[model samples]
Target: MKSLRTLRQAAAIVPIAMGRGKGRSRQALAERLGPLRGASTKVAQLLSARDGEDAGRALEPLPLARLLPVMRAAAPTLLGDGATIGAQGRRASLGQVHRAELSDGRDAAVKVLLPGVESDLRSDLGLMGWVGRRAGRRLRQRFDGVAVDDWIAALGDELLAELDYRAEAEAQGRYGRAVSSLPHAVVPAVIVAGDEVLISTWEGGSALADAVAWEPDKRAQLGEALTGAILHPMLTDGLVHGDLHPGNVAFREDRGGEIVLYDFGATREISLPARQAWRALLRGEVPAWDALLTLGFDAERLAPLRDRLDALAALLFAPFRERNATQIDGAERRARADALLGEHRMVPRLAAPTSAIPMIRTLSGLFTILGHLAAPMELWRVFDGADAPAPALPTRAPGKHVAPALPARLLVRSFGEDGRGVEIRLPFETLPDLEDLLPDSAREPIERSGVDLGALAREAFARGPIPQTLFDDVVEGRRVELRVIEA
Candidate 1:
């Protein structure tokens, strides 16, 4: 009986329905054959899993035959020439991509929504919200924190938006227009119908990992350009590429060594304050908790939370800072990052959680890629010196907004008598220029007099093993620090 049912359902999905029987329901038969619905349900469950072990398990790939029929049915005109399907790469619950040659002799990629994904996502998002709320309540009980209901609500909203390809098309168009003038950055065109189907010009290049493996220098240059493109819009324009992942970025050799960016389904508009926070990070300036309060963060509420952020950042950057004397090997850096990620899989639940997760993941992935390619830390200097060009806002007054001015002096201080170092301190204003501090060469510089201490620290600190003697303190809003340890 089961075998007969399976065969009947498969036949219905094919070019022709083969078997006919009395009292058989087409809807029930179709459901049996349509893996899309099953797969989407599974994906939603995985995504909503409270723990990584439950979430990271992979799902089975759906057959192309089932999807092709749906695509052809929706856009007969586009696929009238009998679409020749190529390789199907990397199947996730959301969708799968195919590399194909269009009948018109153009190389393109087609993305098809998995069967029942839309409906499954809707159900899954609701479940996740419930789980998130429950989790938040538990945390609040244990830690005396408020439930992150707003955050969960924001995530639910974004997830729903992502399920709609039509909305994504509009977003992609907006981003394309914004970065249109920029060189070496590409956003693919989308083709939409009743069911959202996207057709984009195929971007061919080595995966970033492979590119870095082939030529380290080229990887470094690419990393710089990619970082500039990713960060500039966020800091200067208040627009962020919400979904930046290794899979989303492609490297093309022909376009003057360009990095092609794809998938605008998760794009987001950042607030001005968040943009400023990002800029501060790029400049290596850690603003005070009070400053964040001024920008609308609840200081009393976030003071303890800020400590955790500091700890996480320190943990993340420790290798770069403490091991300054040693070379940051790309493979080793990735391994370390993976280990760190493994140690803590749960991200801070915040409003717009989806946006936050992707951005955080992207930052980590980009930095890891850079480290793997041996890209000089100096490449990050672009954000520090000579302000980056901000994205023009259609509504905002021109020239009314300017970047916050850099502080005049940066100071570093060290604490402890002579041998046992207690702490290192740095004043906010005294943060050294990020570009100048990054090591261009593997060799360390020798100490000399009449040299700017900040420059000396930049070179000396580039090599690993931060000295215990160095410490930093702030004075009159200027950056001040004392060094107890030498790297």
Candidate 2:
């Protein structure tokens, strides 16, 4: 029954993804994945960090009456006598957490896994695997067949790992001890663990989402704590809390803004080599192609571009390489990347490594948390030296660095055969949509001149929007100028 329901949900997502825009498709997929409640929903939740949607927001907690019996059964000894389990306080991907008061008068959070969730998740992954292969074959231009299999396999391993409560307890205990020196990081201690139930000391704090609206100084302080909480474990011990979403992490004003981390079920251990490569990438010391290799991209396919790889690397990683750079323009970077991949048609040649998927997922979640805080962090402080541990918060508040102001409009000027000047002005924001907005008459001439207006616009936008000529040359015997205007 579970497999059949997942099948229906999976099938429904296909048409929605094909018929709608990217944002709408993401919303539709999240809506469908929410109900499946296992590996399917886990993937949705991970992607929510990028899509700016709370995929798990709609998840309904299993009723206490339905879950209490399972908790008692899983840990009969722990639930016996004066221990009283209260209502469900949190709903997770695979389980629901309830507040419990033990006979010893200690407060605890009892997390009870839904019955047969492991088997159901396995079934869901199997079905999704089948779907992935079928879709990969049809969409051979965009997805590599083998890479698709590897990615799904990698995701399956990480998702299944979250089902083991014993493993979670161990990871949580290790992480708690690892961050003990950082007074601002709070990792709740594990009290007891059963096969399917994990009991930990009850923790109190407001969600990180709420912290976003606090004063700038407080938000910056919380951001520093969050950065430490996520980076320390990964850099020092290579153990990462895979799900650091706002719901899983909180802020305690009473505790002097300590970051309260919860939900350790998705923790992962990073390998030494992978950790070193990530540090190099973050420090902007390594080439883009090297980072790609670490990420499991196809070296053979990338070989053809070796002659100009450095130039390509500079274009791709300029934002990271520059020290004290304030803004990271992800959109423009993506557009240029799409152009490169489109021109080369190398999307299908890529490969996804099993070991790297979780690391990437961990970083994606961390950046999302940082984005929410929306404050300038002295990120370089995290790696002041080659082997530095996560450093103490800087004595000074985060510095304010202003980016160059964006241009208001784009001006396209051309001279007609009669020596008349013709001009077209477009809103600055429409630069990204330049490809679609151009008519055949104008686009054909630009294409003939071997100039890709879309890529040019993206690169210009990324270089910081100021008064600059985007394109200037003769197109079909007519002098043309395309530039962004400050006004």
Tens-place lDDT digits, model 2, residues 112-227:
89767887777676666656555556455544344444455556666777888899999999999978878799888998888888999988787655777787767767777777
Worst 10 residues of 2 by lDDT: 393-402
Q: lDDT, candidate 2, residue 112?
A: 84
Model 1 TM-score relative to the real fold: 0.57
lDDT of each: 0.47, 0.64
lDDT of 1 by residue, 404-476 (tens): 2322232221211121211122222223443343232211121122235566456434422222123223333
Flag regions of model 2 displaced more than 4 Å. 1-4, 17-23, 51-53, 138-143, 291-297, 301-323, 329-349, 385-487
How close is every model to the real structure, measured as TM-score? 0.57, 0.71
